[model samples]
Every structure is written in structure tokens, then in C-alpha cells.
Target: MNTAAPALEMTGLTKSFGTMRALDEVDLVVEAGTVHCVLGENGAGKSTLCHVVGGSLVPDEGGLRLYGSPYAPRRPADALAAGIAMVHQHFSLVPTLTVGENLRLLRLKNLPRRVARVRDEYGLDLDLGARVSELPVGVRQRAEIVKALLREPRLLVLDEPTGVLGPAETDALLATCRRIADSGHAVVLVTHKLGEVARAGDAATVLRGGRVSGGGPLAELPPERLVPLMIGRPADSLDAGLAGTIGLAADEGVRETGGEAPEAGASGGRREASGPAPRALRLRDVSVRRPDGTTALDGVCLDVGHGEIVGIAGVEGNGQSELMALLGGSLAPAAGRVELGGRNVTRAAPRERSRAGLGVVPEDRLHEGCVPPLRVADNLFLGRLERFRRYGVLLDRRAMDRAAESVLTEHGIRAGGPGALMSSLSGGNQQKVVLARELALDPLICLAAAQPTRGLDIGAVGAVHSRIRGAAASGTGVLVVSSELSELLVLCDRITVAYRGKLLGPVDPAEPDARERIGALMLGAHAPDSGAESAVRTAAES
Candidate 1:
């Protein structure tokens, strides 16, 4: 072992919120020139640890040492001064500002020269003149990383950095992490995916229920040994084949095809030979234009059958967002029709669509899905206040609380109670709450979920998959949009690729080269066959 002093050391770290203790007697160490991974389920104190290190939160009790010197930071600026930088899961950039302008806000000098130098050095290709709000989530992630790298800190903390990235972008970020470590700095990667640990982690620390469960060099501890520590169970006990879906079997050289789609009669399975399955959602020659009058989706045609789950796969900014928005009734199509449950909902409001048995789990849960400042019960019953109205004007708070309590228990959401603020729950639990609310609609005819499992741990991913499958089993047509192809391959019955603005292929996941075919389609490598396009349009119209 090298005898040099470690880059960072924490002893007996603890943090609490009201009656809840987020972190308890935690200890950690990071050696320079190595990538250290922090692994845990959501609410397992990982984000709290990152916040404490980044100076967003101060530990109630702890002692920290930086290169053998006592260190403490009261704010993010102080942490930056001490050579610490953090890239958050949610970006910190001003949405209206350009990348260069955001950098200028950091008070950096030599704007043009330094921005270009850092961008080149870190292989971060960002459009410095582009407004953050106009960029895709993937591009926003790159901007955040670039901002962190520009500081040239001695230690870097990245929290769920790959949650919004595509496969190529994820690979690039891992390579960049390796480069940073090789440059004699310490890097902390907070993530839920085990494949990433195998790919980039030099060492790891596992947290369970806010305490260190197990940790060691990656070489010494394989994924099998780490799985139980992270989720309190053997790898084989994961929900069906989810061990491979979330990469828990990655270190064992498990192939991507190990997790197959559910068998017949299971989720994503076809209905028994009862003629043709009823159509739950259909889009005929649908077209949508952005505010700037640019086409976002052009002449898209699709159909989702009841008891069927269809997936949409593509690189970010390929009209997936617009498609979801159009379905959710937030954006109107320039031409064509959207039918839910065989009724035209072309100009319906979100509430009208909801009443028509449509449920939506939006991609950006924090912003579009729920209100953080409200109580969990209020958020759970949002937009459906009439159901609990006592006198047509007064909300029946007791009834709402009772219903929320049952949902919390049924969904296994960890929160203080229905009265707790939505902001206090962890990301995974927040997502679960959103899902439970949407799925609770008695006659939910169709469900549209976007990036449903992003940033979730192995256990949470399995739970989410099970819930979505349950929805499909109950005869709800499901549409999922995700960047993770592995997830789509396992969860979807038919997969479609979005390129430019057109929809291509209802490829069967059971196809031998399904992943390869979908990848090629995503890149627009070959023009879609005319026959296939005709067949899709026929299915939608029929």
C-alpha cells in the first residue's frame, strides 16, 4: 500500500432532520489518484454525504481532514476555495444563461481562452453560446461537468451524474473520471449502477440505512460480495432477472441479454388469441412544432394496445419530450389526431385527459410531476381534489390522509408520514409516490412513463418494474421513454426508435439482434423500409 497521506478523511459523521437521522456515525476515506465509488439505495445517506462534502449541508457531528489538515467549509464557495467542486444530479446552471455566461458568473477571468482550454482538456464539447433551457438533458449534464472541471479542484464529487445521459455519454463521462484520477486528484462517484463501479471504480464504500455496511478495494470485493451489503439480500433474490437489468451481475461478466422479457401471460405479453387487442392509445399522422416554429415531431403514427407495453428509444432531443408533452395535454399537435381509449383528445386539457383515464409520470419528476413544498398527501391527490371534497368547497383532509397512508404502505415509500413535505423524501421514494398516485386511478386506460427508473438503486428499480408490470397486467396500455436500452429490452413488448421526427419499427424485443437493430435505427443509419412504415400506419388506423 502507498504510504502517502489520504486526500480526504471523515470520522463519525452524522446528520439528522427532525426525528429522522439521515446519516449515522459514518466514516470514509478517499485516496488521491483513484476513483472512489459511493454505493447505496436512495435515502441511504449518499446524497446527504455529497451535500456535506460540497458544503451545502453541515454534518451535525464529524471531523474531517484534508491531506492531513483540519478542514471545514461553511458554504459552497468555501468548499471551492478549498479545492472541492461538485456536480449535482439536478444541474445548477441558470436556464436562461449560456454556458459562457454561467462561467462568467463564477468570476473566472480570460473567459474565451479558459473555457476553450478546459473544454478541450476534459473532452467536454459544450455549445458555450447555447441557452441551457434550450439544450437537452444530456447536454445540460455536460455543461454541469464542464463547470466543475473549470475549477480544477483537487477533489471532485459527482452525484448521479449519468442518470440523464445516454450510453455514449455515460461511457465518455467514465473515461473523463479515469483521466481526472490519473491526474493525481481524488474523485467520488455517487451512483446506483453496479456496471459503472466495475468500469471506473478503483475502490468502493457501501452505505445501508445511513451507515457503512461494507467497503474495500474493487479488486478485493466482487459484485456478489457487494450486493448483499447494498440491499440486504443475496443477488439471486432480486426481482426475477433484475440482477442483470441493473448491472448487479456485471462484475461476473454477465451478458446484456441475460435478462429476457417476461414470458407469455406475464407483463409485456400478448393477450390470449382473443382476436385483436383493443387499442388504448393511437397517434395518426401526428405533428408538433416548437415555440420557434421548428418541427419537433413530424407525421408520427403509433398505437399502444391494452395490456401491451411499448418503448421509445433514441438519443436525447429526438422529439421524445414533445411526444410525452402532447400525450400529457401540455403541448398541442400542429396536425393529426391523438386518441385515448378510442376517443379524440386532440384539444383536451390535462385534467380532461386524466378524467378520461390517462396517467402520466413525467421525465422531470421534481418540476413536472409533483409539488415539493406541499404535503405528501396533497401531492398524492393533486388535480383530483373533488374526490375528497366534503361540501363541494372544503377538502376532506382526513379522508385524503387515510388514503395517502395506505398508498405509502402499499408502495413501500419511506417517509415520515402523509403530512411530511414532498421535498423531504429521497429521489427514489419521490418517484414511487408519483407512480403510486398515477396508477391509483381506478380505470387508468393508458400510462405514459418517461425515464421511469433513472437514478434508482437495484432494489428500487425492481420495485418500479414490478409496479409497471402490474399496471400492464391490469390491462393498461403502457408507453415508456428511456435512455437505457437494457431497461427497454427487458420491460417492453415492442420497441420503437425515434429519429429526427419520425417513428420507426415496432421491433420485437425477442429478436436476436434487437439491441443492435434499434441502435442502428437511432443513428438513422438506414432509411426505414417503406413496408414497415405502411404496416405501422395501418395498425394505428385499424
Candidate 2:
């Protein structure tokens, strides 16, 4: 019997622009029928390397050998022809299209009806007739898989596959990848979350500052070890802010391997003002109905105290987006009163909400958080453009530049300048920009929706957590809505598991039961004997 050569080999790969080197002599080896996880921070040459493999970006130097042959794909189709398929962190599926239609989008010759049968066999549970826009985030991702499988590739590259998935969805997606690997194919997983790399990977490659830092099988290094190797240096400390709030003790279990985890949520800060009032965000029977007569937020009633960080965790469709919109001031509450900072603001415009001491880090930052076309400094100061003004009728560029520089340095943002276009920054940097801008407002109440989603490495995530915790500590009410249970467990003081559309109450997150129970809840299962409802009921009604 003859053994086959490695499925793919890349050596001394390099790419540069002017004085900056995007990829500097990078090397990667992926074996057939095995999973190789590549770990890196944002802008650590992961995307550039993948672009070279996918034939989107040409490498400046070095070579690639696919199956012992020189590999150069001029177009994405060229890579597709060579049996290489890529699933990106962000997918491109028509919201209006169906599963079967999406699968048949690439292959006009293939029968749509025939491919729909294959989708079911995989237990992907995609309703071919259902619209992609109407489906959940997980279902949309599944459609991307079906789109890739239609090409039937020999090698699969998944970039941050679980970035947007919840606990349950992430497990399911990892199972899909393993099944594909079992069928005599190669898998390359790119991610910054060390947990995912440690859990799902068979072999590991660490990339830091645009270079390969280490290599070997997964067993050779634990997630803890692989992290520092990928980051080149130990990430900065957790800043003490998150540790106090998230229950981080001296032991620090699940040690970080890559970037430092952001500080935990604003844990201990100013005490809540005491009075007849509960010092909480009170919404009385808030109802939001769409133009089409579809009710998104039902008569929801809830309160978040002045010095507390309240987190709402749920699957994608479970009114998380709608609730965020209501709180953030993007959509007005159709009925009932909204109160914050001892004032009514339900009928107020978004700008009015911002003026009423309300800060927001929206879910879709690219669309609403920051304008991509604007410069980083301009966007950073967009909220407080007036603050930079020295005169009654002037825009202060110098003051704004100084503030922008301070934010970049304080938050560890890597960018060319405050004048640098926001579009040029990496995803994590963009998120940092958003956080810096919102926190600068110093609002009394903050509503964050998936603030740290795409492009964040584990280290940066820790920093974001610390800041959020700081705000709550400073006596600013905070409400966070996210799909990742692990994130809520780490950053939230009290977690409310939202299923379908109903709001579950604030439950304390602890070990042992959290991972398993949260996973089950995300899948729409009744919580274990010790569940969200029971946990909420037993808590001293504070």
C-alpha cells in the first residue's frame, strides 16, 4: 500500500505592501483526514493566509503545494475547482432565498430538487422552502455549509465558525466539521478563542504578529500553552476590574493561552443611591409593534439597578434584537412608559435617549455603531463632536485628535491615526473604537447588544469585559444581550436565559451547572432540575 503526501503544504509564504509586511515567511502544513486549528489575534496574518489559499490575495513571496503540485488560484472558482471550500465568519446568503435555492445558486446544471435531499441526509434541518432571512443565525450558517458542500471539496477552511453561534449551536457546528473530517477530508479551523481551538482541534498552529510561532499535534500543547505561543508574548493582565465582578479568584482556572480576557463586567464600583425608588430601570408593560402589525416586544416589564450589570442571554430569534432596539432608542416603545435617570424617555428620539444619559453599543456596529467610511478619530468623536469645540462656532480638530490618540493608547487600539479611515482597521480594532466612543459618553444607562462579536481575540475580549464592569461599578446601569452563554457567564453578574421570546429572570452563574445547563437552555430545553425559573424564584428579591 502507498501512503499519500500531505493534503496541503505552505512554506516561506510572504506578502508585503510598501514598508508593511502582511505575511512574513509564514508556514502551514495540513494533513489529510485531520483537523488543524490555526490560532491568532486580530490582524495576525490569519485572513491574509486564507486569502492566499482561496486565491483571493496573491502572495508576494513563497509557494503553495496542493497535493504535491504548484497551487495558484487566480479566482475563488479556481480554488473551488481544486476541491478547496471556505466558510467565512460572515456568510453571503440571500435572506429571501431558501436552502435548496441557495445550494443551487452556484451550480446551475445541478437539480435543486436533488440537492435538497442531500441536505436532509446530513440532519442539517434546513427548511428548503423557508426563507433564509426568516431563519436563525445558526440556520443561516448551515446554509453556508450546504453551499460549500455543493462543491464537494477535499479540503475545508472554517474561519471563526462559532463566533456568532450560541453554546448549543457551536457544539452542533463542530459536530458537522468532525463528520466532514471523518470522511477522508482535511479541516483547517481559524479562531482566536482558545477554548474552541482546544475543544475541537486535533492539531494546532499558532500565529503571532504575522508569523508562525509554533506547531505540533493538539496533544503536544494544552490550550493554555498554545495561547502564549500564538500571541508571541504573554497578554497583559486582566486589569482587576473584571476579576472582581466575574468571580475570578487567585487560582484563575481555564488559564488564558492567547490574549488576556478583557476585565470582567464593571463589578464593584459606586453604590446605588438609596431612596423610595428601587434605583432600577423600570419599564411598565412596554409593547412594540411593527408596521406590519407583528409584535416584537410584548408587555415586557423589567428593572436593572443603578449599580448592577444585567445580562440577557438567548437564541437569535428570541426577541433579543427587538429588546435591544427598544432600550437603545432605535425603535420607540409603542405603548407603556420608559424611564431612566428619573425621567421618561420612551417617546424621545434616539438622540434624545443619548442625551438622557443613555449609551449604546449596537449589535450591528458596521451598520449603526460606526460609519466605516469616516476616519477612526472622526468616528470616535462623532458622539461628542461638540465636546471638542473650543469656540461657539468651530469644530476642533486638534482637541479631537488628542482625545482619539488617548483612546487608542488607553484601549490598546492599533491603527495608523485618528485620521486613518475606519475601514482600514481590523475588526477587533473597530469594536474597540465603538467601546471607546460609547464609554466616553458616561451615560447613566447602557445597552450593549453583541458588542464583542466578530474579529475579537480572547485577549481583547477580556479588556472589553473589564470596561463594561467598570461602568456598572461607576453606578451606570448596564444591560447586555448576547447569544454566547460562555460570555454571559464570564461577564454578567446575573444571567437571564431568554427562550423563544419570553424574558427569564436574573440568575447567578456558577460552575458545574452553568456550562451544561446553559447549553441545554439554548437548545430550547427545560432547564435541569435547577433551572432559570427555579434559580430566579429562590433568589432574595432584591
After superposition, candidate 2 runs with Cα above 4 Å error: 1-3, 94-104, 108-122, 127-139, 232-265, 268-275, 278-280, 289-295, 389-398, 451-454, 510-542
Q: Over the full model, what C-alpha lDDT does candidate 1 score relative to the true structure?
A: 0.82
Residue 542, model 2: Cα distance from true site in angstroms = 7.7
Residue 11, model 2: lDDT of 90
Worst 10 residues of 1 by lDDT: 531-540
For model 2, residues 312-356, the per-residue Cα lDDT tens digits are 777766666666677778777778777886688787887777776
Candidate 1 shows a clash count of 0
Candidate 1: misplaced stretches above 4 Å?
1-3, 250-268, 271-278, 528-542
Q: What TM-score should be assigned to candidate 2?
A: 0.84
